[model samples]
Target: MGDTTIAPPPTAQRRAGVWQAVLLLAGSCMPVLGSVLITPILPQLSEHFGDTPGAEVLVPMIVAIPALMIALFAPFAGQIVDRLGRKTLLVVAMFAYAIVGTAPAWLEALPAILLSRVLVGVCEAAIMTVCTTLIVDYFHEERRRNRYLGLQTVVTTLAATAFIAIGGALGVGGWHTPFWVYAVSILIGALMVISLWEPTAAEAGEPEARDRPAKVRIPWARIGVPLLVTLFGGFTFYVIVLEVSYLVVGTGVAADDTATIGGVAAIASLATAIGGLSFAKLSKLGHGVLLPLAFGLQAVGMLVIWIVPGLPGIGVGAVIASFGSGVLLPSLLTWVVAAAHFADRGRVTGWWTSAFFLGQFLTPILVAVLAAGLGALPAAVGVVGIVALLVGAAVGFALRKASAAVAA
Candidate 1:
């Protein structure tokens, strides 16, 4: 180990914080991987339950359902973390996530599986905000925080790749293969419960270090930009998730090749991971230039893939867009946290999370309707492309405003 040195409060010495970063990042990745691991298996889900016509809908419902619940509850997650403390909330969410994720694979009844998914959703809302607050504890200063957040995004992307590969392998084995991805939740959840420490208010950057239940007020004026941006990015993401499986399975790709879907997605997410990690090294334009630039690349990529529909073309487009999203995430998140009032970070972040999931929830349903009516591939890809363009323009506006304000 390198020489360890003591530092004053609010100083984040990079070398010593490595393990802390890993633990927190790993803890944070559990749900993201959990959600997507099942994506490639949706066709299989539809076939299995297609006895009734609407049973096919359950596939998206299972994935998006959790997001729906999170959308509703995320506004309060920060408050709960503030009231209960970070470690306690993290432990509970992790445990609940483990059981809920695992039970779906092991249980006999479909209802049980659905119920388990809902439970996992409940747990995920708590996990997301708490982990975010924990990051504030681990890193100090804007540069350090953005880099760390980039690292965290990369971790999730890498996990997404691994789980996608695993989901594919299992899906190829039969429909049951994807469900086995639940094992990851158990292991990760255990790690969180056993190893992580709950940071107090001082650690999380809230005012009080002691246990006093406090109501966190929303800082709409302060966090308006970041919160809104988060919601927009989420909308773009949901639109893709809405149409991906249908584009493949409905358009002559074999339903059994969950591996193919996973492979393609991983390819894109890998680009995303790289883009985000690369942005971390830069001191300037990581937010001002990089976010909107990435967003623009994403828009172009989406349009290209939509016009020419094939795995090769579509995958390339997604890769471009994915990297853009990757670059934006860390910068935007850091911006939001920095902009919020110290007293109300929790509440502000809670609303931010809610907006993020709300985008995830609403866009997919709208895309689903379009896919059913207008044909899956054309509607999903076209709509996603348009959404990406609109969001890119909006991000450009935000960047200009942020820059002008900073200069003024």
Candidate 2:
């Protein structure tokens, strides 16, 4: 009989273990900090620049600008990441994020502040792309990668909560106070230099693969459909985060109370964090089981917010929706990453990141369109909820067929 043996797949050696995880997770928080850190004070920032032309539109740009830039620049960042390596770009991006992110503190001109925010977004694109790519890099196993993805969401959500609270408190001083929070990136970047070392497939015994030319054909069909789905996923996920403060004010719940708005946002974030924590265990159910639940919950939550009135109702809706959003993120991320080739991880992830932030950038505009036709923001939210329900049902139906096919 012919001798037969199965060789195990190569595994990357742990470079710095827990410290590496800690630093990357910490770095991950920086990308989101851009919006959450300043959201509570947006009204103030708008007013401060009100006397200057276009304050109405431009003030809000501070929140969306970074997201837009991330959408625009992330693909390029991914190219750099795949070719140049993860650590160097990440470290530079982190340092750049700190400097550009803090520019609003001293800048007096409205246009100048907007410029800084745009620059901050560029850094965020690189930071988010590289950090996510590294998470996949550092962990080879599917379950373990899923776990870290969950952890990454958890840490970012919690940090958003903390930063929102801090921003609210600091807004008592002035809108500029919260901009100081970006300085934390300096420390994170420093820790990265100290603790983070690059890992390669060669180190895992795939020298031939590593030595292959960088110019390889992308498996577009594999990653493309998911990227497209995640674009909508991104749209749905960011609705509450970007619009809840406005919703609270519009509903007559928290009139000019940044602290209360911040508190509500934080609670919603907590719910998302809770959902994220469940991904590892729940993931075994697979997309067929999970997507419906995630979208279904979100639709119900949005419907609740629409039909019910008052802060308590909104709070309940927010928490429920946030949970769905949390689950949705890691689910989509894990799906896309798993489908991608190891060599294409960075660029594929960059496209994925771009899709996500692009959704974020489009959210307010889409909501505005709905609001215009629907007659009110809450009504628009309800209509959107119905749309989500339809999407969920459709996905559930398709998944059932797929599952049946597999069983058959």
lDDT of each: 0.69, 0.84
Clashing pairs in 1: 87-198, 170-177
TM match of model 1 to true structure: 0.81
Q: Evaluated with TM-score, which candidate comes out highest?
A: 2
> Per-residue lDDT tens digits of candidate 1, residues 32-113?
7657788667777788877855676666687777887777776778777656667787777776776677776656556667
Report the C-alpha lDDT of model 2 over 133-227, residue by residue, as the tens digit.
Answer: 88877765667778889888899989888887788789999988889889999999998987876778654234566667767666786677778
Runs in model 2 deviating more than 4 A are 1-12, 202-208, 211-213, 257-263, 396-408
Cα lDDT for residue 366, model 1?
Answer: 69
Q: Kindly give the stretch of ten consecutive residues in candidate 1 with the minimal lDDT sum.
A: 204-213
Error of 1 at 315 (Å): 3.6
Candidate 1 clash total? 2
